[model samples]
Target: MDLEVGDKVSLIIGTETHLGFTVLIDESFEGLLYRNEIFEELKENQRIAGYVKNIREDGKIDVSLQPQGFRNAIELDTEKVIEAIYDHDGFLALTDKSDPEDIKKELRMSKKAFKRAIGSLYKQKQIVIGEEGLTLVKE
Candidate 1:
């Protein structure tokens, strides 16, 4: 694909970003995501994912790998989810999950993606859904 600044890409295991010990994208390109730029706390080898935000003249390409589309794109889900889980009880109903829906209304993703994130949070046991609403399982 024509990789340029502000393009989204995925990185699998055993890749290098050329800049450092990053899990590279396309197994060749170097991603440009910094810790401060990420809304989520990136763990070591946690798989840096974002968009390509720059391409330098030195033949090194810069990628964001952020799940969010671009700078102009709506903010990502994980951050919002974390915020909602912390602000609310973490029991957002499929029908009453307002904060996540605020994101959805802007992002235009299928419901599947939204629910998948909830499933991920559930799997991580970070949050639990109940009749009371979504509640944070951990701090």
Candidate 2:
């Protein structure tokens, strides 16, 4: 079967293998959703909306549940976005590069969302982005 890129499809999580896990794209081909693409918490028999990531030379096709236009689990904990911004001392400074991405991962927010939150803090004078990581200006 031929699979085109950017094709929106829903898949059911199938067997988890050492090399990669399988997704039942349909009755015919079982796509491989590698560990890299499976960033968030995923369970066996979970259904997910995905895009046709690519087809490998080894005949293993891949799917990305993190495809564009997909809503993440972050919305479930919107308050964490607030906490990441506020707890990180308002400014996600240069030194905070690692934390920002990590926070986004744990918080399930995109880097853009993190930046926007910091921007809001900056405008409100709650914090400042400078040479160091976020500084608690409110103190």
Candidate 3:
């Protein structure tokens, strides 16, 4: 197979099964996109970008919508949270203590990712964590 782990590819969303969503990768190979890894809404036949996560010995491929690796994940999530904060008038009703589901519903990201982004923002002094939630630090 020409595709290797971390290679960016095109994906066509397929059927949802007990495991996850089946996908056609690069319109050639079949791959599985796990439910837990997916953060956004997807529909059958929808085309999207993905990265090859793994290739099993049995020839099955695993795909992910987001690029893998610590730095990539943190950067993407951090940018997403910053944009959401700006869109919400510089205030967000989310904190480290917020429910995971609520964080996902509000930001379409996992709570772990949300926390990392917020933690980074706090360290950068770009935002403030308060009793009610988070607020963008005005310059």
Candidate 4:
């Protein structure tokens, strides 16, 4: 398939499996996108951009919605959190202590990713993490 790890590819969303959604990669390869890795709702026949996470020796492929590196993922997740906060009048009721399902439902992100993004935002002094929620730091 000439595909390598981290290669960008197109995916046609397929049926849901216990593990994840099956996808048609580039309309040629069959790959699986794990449920835990997904942050948004996907429907059958949905088309989206994806990256090749792995090509198993058994020929099964694994794909990811976010680009495979910490830098790329953190940046995107941070932006999403920022936007959500802004949309909520500069505060979002989510914190590191929030339930993972709550974070996923609210932000479509895993708690780990949410924590990393919030950590980045906190380090940048862009947001304040309080017991109530996250507040955008005003200049």
Top candidate, metric TM-score: 3
Best by lDDT: 4
lDDT measured at residue 123 in model 1 versus the true structure, 0 to 100 = 79
Query: Each candidate: how many clashes?
Result: 20, 0, 0, 0
- Score each candidate by Cα lDDT: 0.53, 0.64, 0.93, 0.95
Q: Any idea how many clashes model 1 has? A: 20
Report the alpha-carbon TM-score of model 1 versus the true structure: 0.41
Model 4 TM-score (2 dp): 0.94
Better of 2 and 4 by lDDT: 4
What TM-score does each of the candidates earn?
0.41, 0.53, 0.95, 0.94
**Model 3 per-residue lDDT tens digits across residues 14-82:** 999988899999999999999988888999999999999999999999999988888888899999989
What would the per-residue lDDT of candidate 1 be over residues 36-83, giving only the tens digit for each residue? 333333455565456766677786655553444532432355455666
Name the regions of candidate 4 deviating beyond 4 angstroms: none
lDDT string for model 2 (1-139, tens) is 6677667787888888886678888556789887755646778888877778887788777887655432332332334544665766564443336465575565555555556555665676766677665564666
Query: Root-mean-square deviation of each candidate, in angstroms?
Result: 11.3, 6.7, 1.0, 1.1
How far residue 137's Cα lies from its native spot in candidate 1, in Å, is 25
For model 3, what is the alpha-carbon lDDT of residue 24?
A: 100
